[model samples]
Target: MTRLCFLKCLLDSHAPINLPHNVEILVGRSKITKIKDQSCSRQQLSLKANCDDCIVEVKQIGINPSGLDGFSLKQNCLYKVGHESRIEILLNNYIHLIEFQPPPDNFSPIKRNKRKIEDEEITVKKKKCNKTPDKDSVLSIKEAMEDVWESIDEGELYIYTSKGVKSSKKIAAFDMDGTLIKTKSGKVHPVDTNDWQLAFPVVPTKLKEQLENGYKVVILSNQAPIGKGRVRIEDFKKKIENLVAKINIPIQVYIATGKGFYRKPTPGMWQTLIEKKNDGLSVDMDSCFYCGDAAGRVANWAPGKKKDHSMADKLLAENLRLTFYTPEQFFLGHSIANVPMAKPEFIPTEVKTEPFNDNLISDDKEILVLVGYPGSGKSFLAKQIEKKSSYKYVTVCRDTLGSWQKCAAEATRLLQQGKSVIVDSTNPDIESRSRWTSLAKDMKVVCRCAKMATTKAHAQHNNKFRELMRINHLPVNDIVFNTYKNKYKEPTTNEGFKDVIEVKFNPSFDDEKSERLYKMYLLEK
Candidate 1:
């Protein structure tokens, strides 16, 4: 049987302390990290967790200090710690997060090898006398980073490069998040700025080798949190500096904080480098290479690993016309796997062979109900219908009109005036489609269902593209997609429609740049 972690203490720069349910475990200074800080006690806090309920029975035992989520802990009293509790030991600002995790299988873990944890922590190094925090470290880092960072594209993109980092023709570009480092706590996202470690032990060695080979080692990464305000720019700057400092190599870095040209697969960052920052020298795409983890590999691409987050990294190399390598293939010398890649649903480059059929409406007295995903270009198609029909059909959208009842009323009002009506909305279910079809039946006009054949992948691509390109685009979450998929019933003549017209997703862009971006991989590979 697998031993499940009932309650686990996640410490920075330390091995996770896995505690079984109902069993008490002590957490403190050297037990977590070797950092000798006098503000922490040898036994700071004692915790007993119940994984099923996701609650911890914790007690402060040490006088040095221990607090839950910045709240004062009363000594000698048991506190019911919630799943979100963070136990701080005041140990040089290092936080010890205590989380309760339920067992994966049916059987709840009754006990664990508690003795092993104690044995492991016992081999700690000798502690120093009353060690204090280093204020100079912050000052030194700020000094080193002064005048090194600059932003463009209205702060969507940030470039951080020191004068010491020399430019070269043979580039060694890499993705930072999964390629060079990963969250130390093994969480999908870093809990704090300090919560990252090298992805592989030999990361530094590999980077050093790149520099030795006369390649300009450059790090390019998309950090959306920076733009979303989840992560402060100053904090991320410190993280980048810390990472480069650890490697102790002359390396430049580009960070795409927001979605746009600078974001990978667009080649904007690479273009900017060659155009502005490459010391008036052109880069050699033939010899240069890029490395990232998002190679469009599926789940179990590696043993016990999930699929890659996106195809941005691999697509970036393709856009730059450079050779690409997964971090595994580059650092570990692993051969490339023959996994099938996820391709874009539409080819924007393919010239429009056949003219678009504008005869969507059979008559002026008609109701055309559109049904598809939100980003499936429902509104765009509705506008085209209104134009092709020469203003004969008035578009009724739930998004603008506020409710389906209002949409039906407006459609009824338009139909009564002898004008055609186009219902533009994600009418995913039969009930939603029935609203318009039922109205058409009462009015004695033909009700046709125009079904958009846009896949989930394609819809997501269009959604992302709009979000990045349009300034006033509303955000569409995955929950919306899930809701549509769960309730969607394919529209047929069974729903009282005169005809179900199948509409293929053919994108109409305002410019060539947009046309190119739409052709690229935007979905998570």
Candidate 2:
């Protein structure tokens, strides 16, 4: 979180300040420190350092100027390092100066690089923990700061191990937030330590039992909010430490800060752990099981519990071919029924083809309008028409185009060259469909509406599956899908569509990954 503005000026000449005026320079201390801006003003350059042992003074450059050497500034003027500053220093061999410019009047204050006191505070705690601790049991301050040896993904993923017997083949993995513990305030995510409480009174007992049963407990959780740069990494670290202390057992923890193969249901973390951290012991996949809260289930809230957030945990188990259980099932000994979702229409493979027949339109010049929800496979179907059909149609999707109007313009140009165009967008309303039909009519070509036979539940399921799978596609959230649903108006022949064909959901994926994603679309809400 630290945003350091390093101002370094090498002694190239004796008179450095004589070079340029209005020269911008960064001023940073040799040692890391936090300077809280109390005024909260873009124009105000006043700053206060949190360290009581440090003092700011204008001195000779060679005296370390406290790491401010290159700044082109004036003497005896109040200044701030990151926001605004101007300083001048004299040295025996060269003159060093540094200047920090204030932001523009309209600039946002939120853009300021904010740093938390967590690192400094944590370093102090680590120093205390390092003293007189066992070399193998407790990590040295340097080792604790190092990245996990098994992690290949981006972002800072800290690994902490407890002092306990290691297991080569058996590992019991559990999720953190909702599975092991929850906020005492009943909030989804807690802002502070005091807000948390154990998910159940028996959590510690259950973990101890697992340890006694020769299972090395490991925590695999997704903490995506950390990647947003708001939540301090030290906060997450402190939480993990507190959880381990509460459990009072040897365990390992891994938190995926963002979406990636390491995130749940991808098996990247699992693969990395068993391959690199297991000390050459082969993992018994049959005996090892994963527990998480996102097992697809009917809602547990209010009159009818809302459906579980997702089926990511269950799917992760499926991907790994391991046993899967909900927190309630594993901890509370409850049998939560697996909620049925839409069945996937077809199996997906490494190479995906259009799941349904898309040759309904002839190779003759025509304007084909597509209508569906965000995750209703409109884009997939459109790509199929271009890939599998004889038309070799020019497909235009709103996702890639700047606007639908731009899509129409492209279609107009392509059709002028005697090319058939497929408008592969969610043409939800009659007015939207008319934009294409009007173009086709003006060109004396037939317009057809290929309404996808996809339901709301199916679309939502598909969207969630896409997100969970981390597919290389634009993410479609509930808001985006809902907005399309609200604006949808069934197309009619009167709207200029010469024919309307209901394209069935018959996607075929050549790979298991693609097939799993398609099944998500088929899952009944």
Candidate 3:
């Protein structure tokens, strides 16, 4: 029997594959293994074994470069592989040692054992042959890299294509990690490459129904671990491919790989689908829908259930103005109801009509020192006070000056010129506030502290909102907020301030659109 073996094809070694002499046996991504490597072509190589010579002629037809015994084959050319050789695919991305395991006892070609050959061939044929994927798949994963996927926004967003996914007027979008599949390891995050299974038994049937009903299936996922260095990019990508292959249906995938515009609760990916990936077809908003596990349900909303991870998915659907549902509601027969999440304490619409300051407005020259968390709206309030002619002041912001010393220098200059200065920085403690208060004494102006009424939770909510909105500011990390909270001391008249003003948080939106988003839940918990 003219037999060959692929050694080291997988973590678990593959068995020898028996070949029919003189017949061109097809070897490809689908034929080789269930795990599809996009770098490896579907029709990667063709092999014809010579029973007499114990050699195989391999034709390099695929776009990916192939190595035969360390010799690179010319495009569309044939290279003769000896009894024992090594083939490197895609520059050693995968290496397989090929061995010629001829019939036992060095039997001659003419006297090949028919029964043994038949048995071995049957086993290898079963291993090698699987039904090819549907031809209607939309993706072109043949070449090493093709138009099947595109990474934009500096790899923050990654959009993928499949063989048969057709853009229709309607979209049936779903989240992947929790809604479609869960880690078989029973962990919140996947333990490794193999740690996954369909989230529920009915997911496939429900999704297939969507496909049959002319709706495009899409996986809109947030895989921040790729950028966070928690998971290898290649491994996660292979997992995605495996999930798609298991579904066995054409669908598109949108991955937000970072904490940026494409992340959920932001309309970046949805807008991209409409503006770019939709094949020039306008989407029917009324027919479109989204389903996810992060539906903002509170803890114990169901038996043994924890609080939903975040309201981001529900907020995403809200921003898109599409029908939203939990995976249970969409796939299982769970009743659809309003997704309940505790609204953030501060929404622009609910801002109180109370004055920003507890005291009356004055044109008196004074040093206005603000104290709070990093995103406590102090700088914004300072700018607002600067805009008023009666409260005109040169804002001495530490953020712009880059240091407290620079802020002191600028404030000294402003005060020397008889201009009142509003120092906008997180003066969280007595020590932090004393510097500005001391400066006020040096300037011989009455110092007043405006301790913002916004709580730490409210500031965190605002920080997340700004991140989702892509506002012109760097994201405030938890360390910054925690540092302020840890050091916070209540501002009082005892800190040498003439007045300790409690500034109520009365949010004002730039437009109706901003106001609408602010009303949506921003905090995950």
lDDT of 3 at 480: 78
Model 1 spans > 4 angstroms off: 1-147, 153-155, 186-188, 338-354
Q: lDDT by residue for model 3 over 1-525, one digit each (tens)?
A: 435433334222244455567778665576454437786687677777776676677786777656543224444777676444555554333555455564334534342110110000111111332323232222223211211554554456666666666777789999987899999999888888789999988887888899999888888998876644456656766787788888877777888876656788777788787776777788999999999888767877777888877877887887688999888888787885644555534443455545555242346778888887877788778877877735458798776666788889998888788788888988888998899889888778889888888888788877877766656554477777888888888989998999888876667678877776676555544
Taken over the whole model, the C-alpha lDDT of each candidate is 0.71, 0.59, 0.69
Give me the runs in candidate 2 sitting further than 4 Å from their true place: 1-152, 156-158, 296-311, 332-359, 387-392, 454-473, 505-525
User: Compared with the true structure, what per-residue lDDT tens digits does model 1 show for residues 80-152?
Assistant: 7554455655511455555544333343534221011000111101222132223211011111222266555
Model 1: lDDT of residue 367 = 92
> For candidate 2, lDDT tens digit of each residue in 1-525?
222222223222222221122333222232111213222112212223211212223322222222121222222344334322223232111223232222333434342222111121122333334343221222322123322212222342445555443745888998887889889886666867556778989999998998888787888877766654446666767777778888887777877765544667666667656875676678899889999887766554324555666666766777677898888789988765554432223222322343456465576789888899877877777777877765458787776675787888899898988878888888888888888888898989878889987887667666656655545454454666788889998887888777888886655556876665454222312
Off by over 4 Å in 3: 1-147, 336-341, 344-361, 390-392, 461-472, 504-525
lDDT of 1 at 263: 78
